[model samples]
Target: MRRSVLVAVMAIVSTVAAGCSSDPTDPAPTTSAASASPSGKPTDISFLVYGAPAEVKAYRSMVKQYDVDHPGVKVHLVEVSSADAALRRLRKGEVPDVFLMSRRDLGEIVDAGINQPIDELLDSRGVDFTDLYKRDSIRAFSHSDRLECMPYGISPMVMYYNTNLVDFSEMAEAGLDVPKNHATWTFDQFAEAARFGARRGAKGVYVDPSLSGLAPFVYSGGGSLFDDDRDPKRLDLASDGSLEALTTSLELLRKGAITPTPRELRSTSALDLFKAGKLAMMAGFRTLTPELRRTPGLSFDVMPMPALPDDRTLGDASGLCISAKAVNTSAAADFVVHAIGKDAVSDVAAAGYMVPANTEVAESDAFLQQDRMPAHAYVFNRSVKDIVTLPLIESWPALERAVHGDVYQLFYSRVIDIEALTKKIDEESKAVLSPPKASVTPSPSASASGKN
Candidate 1:
């Protein structure tokens, strides 16, 4: 009875899964493929995608163009608000033929048995893995000695500062040290800038109250996120290097006079505050660019995360995956190959949010729109060299959730015990990272006492 109820809920969710379309004048989407073409029967395959409206529009445009370029292949686009939502559909057995997924989530998706190994399929489609995509990105999607997905976007975390609030020219005039190179700065310089920006009712900066938000700084200071990189048993935030990094970062990040107050943050997000010019800076990936561009009166530019003597940052890599349950595997493979090709990736890159894994597109005007707000767009391309990708672990999402509150407290709480807090965080993480083994059940024959 419970199973039937779940099926009914999923059926309803599937009906509305076509999501928003790029063009309002376009006809309503059909769950199935369009009627057979005159020349031959068309193969219908559904694709699941998620991103901002503009990014989604870019994908919709890509699908429209793909249909025009390849006859007798109809690609249905499925839009969801987030990766979690897409995973929900897959977990409910509503797997689409093809989907876009984050490399970090590869372990979870693979464990769920929804995604298929696509190395052979991609090779069959003539994809030049070495020449086409970024090397680290390709390695990010490999699991169990096979490529699980085709690398799409490889975005590293960068500092987005309001030019008006954190003026380099003003800093130099005031005798504060400015970066000799605009692409890089030191942690001490970053602190000075934050203090400089904290003036005239504007806060200096805001890093997200999560592990992902703090990772770049930790790693830049020569710290590790896990006790074991290959098979992490617990978080390593309490280790010597990691603790030192966090201690240094929190000194600046936790300054009440230079950051948003808890009450203010509860009322409005750091991103919204930054958009309103009430905040000086924040750390984000390429996806923040499009929305920031849309905000009026906001002048912003990108820079590498402040180096702790070493240039290091976190990365977000996404890829295209084919469903193990897909009926039209060949059709899906064709679409995946075409989607990552130069033209399709360029269309998406033009949207101003993606740092394409495609080598050509990464270096093209499509990504580095020289005319755009971020004059130093090359920072993104350069920062890729310093990205420290998190290890693929099935319980990553859960681990993050378990320690989120502690991480937030470590960043925002007054009078925090750094050592105690980090130790507690490591302990909490183990519950998710290395859960206890389940007890074995005894056989009935072994347990029997000759009594029924």
Candidate 2:
């Protein structure tokens, strides 16, 4: 589920599970490893990133801001080649004082007891951890429903195409509106355009469902992820809406829209095909964020992920985590809060690293529709509510890898009926997402240092 962009070009979609990266806190473990020196005088803090240089730069700049303002805390930025590597370092007790990691997997690290909590620190800092993102998102890090992690940066999904490659003329011939940032379309129209691309010596789209780009498909189709209104974690993998979402994705593949031709998927990578502009509608996923779009030759635009049978948008958020082992809890917490604050939001958004997570940043005049990047900013406004909300089940490691992998298999196998596939997914999901029945166990050490 995690690997470098060099290993898999589909890393854009792979953002859902871009996998492990190196942690600056410790060296690569040979047979075994040791923890960071607790004896350092400067109070060194380590931050890991599974993101591009631009993001690293943005993160560094923000940290510098904290340094300038606080003047006492020292922060270290460790460029981890992947996210998983950082997690490994954390488990081995060699991770940075603060992870600054992205995704729910960070929450998994907290569950494993390697990280510390920062609620008290946040409260003292006047930062509203809960308000940074939607309520449900906060649950990603909850231990016994207490805060686990806070959202750092978030972006909405959209449709991205190499405009030079799409034949808008042909779209006019078919009376299609050539969808824009605000203008969405039905799956039928999307399929038609994809088939049109294929007929004209193109691959239509490169939307491998196994990637992060698959989020909106589930949401726009009106799918519910996990049934969490109870004590058990039940997955609704095969609900009518979910099944429709899955089937539509599969149908697009069959119609020559989403690719990796059953064979290419087995061999070549979706990112390779997409980078070649052979893909028509990538239906941009997490990459809609600025840090990602600025990657060297991405030469793409941010269009809202196509609408489903109903019009809905999908948004996703992942961010830096303050390790339970965090020593400079004050410094780490301050940096994360500022990163999502109004001060840095506009710059991050304008830089196109990711959609700014700040309410003000997303609506800033700088982000308003522009000539160079017309479809760039509207994503968050429309899709925030519709994100194929990330699954909260702790086995996300196993569930995301297993269930998602199998769903893709079913798409290619075409052996099981959609209904059967849905049923199997439902049964397996219920088992996988089920939560504990009793009150959550108390945290190992209740010494939280977060500020609100």
TM-score, structure 1 vs. true = 0.88
Clashing pairs in 1: none
lDDT per residue, candidate 1, 1-452, as tens digits?
Answer: 00000112223222322243332112232221334445577888999998888899999999999788766788899999877787778778888999998777787788778899887666544466655565667667765556778778999999999999999999999999888876789999999989998898999989888889889988999899888766778899999999999999999999988889899999999999999999999999999998999999999998899998789998888889999989777778777867887778999999998899887899999999999888888899889878876666775678889999999898778889999999999999988888888899878886795556
Per-model tally of clashing residue pairs: 0, 46
Tell me the RMSD of model 1 versus the true structure.
9.2
- 82 Cα displacement, candidate 1 (Å): 1.7
Where does candidate 1 have its weakest 10-residue lDDT segment?
1-10
lDDT of each: 0.82, 0.55
Name the 10 consecutive residues with the lowest summed lDDT in model 2: 1-10
Q: Cα RMSD (Å) per model?
A: 9.2, 12.3
lDDT against true structure, model 2: 0.55
> How does residue 134 of candidate 2 score in lDDT?
47
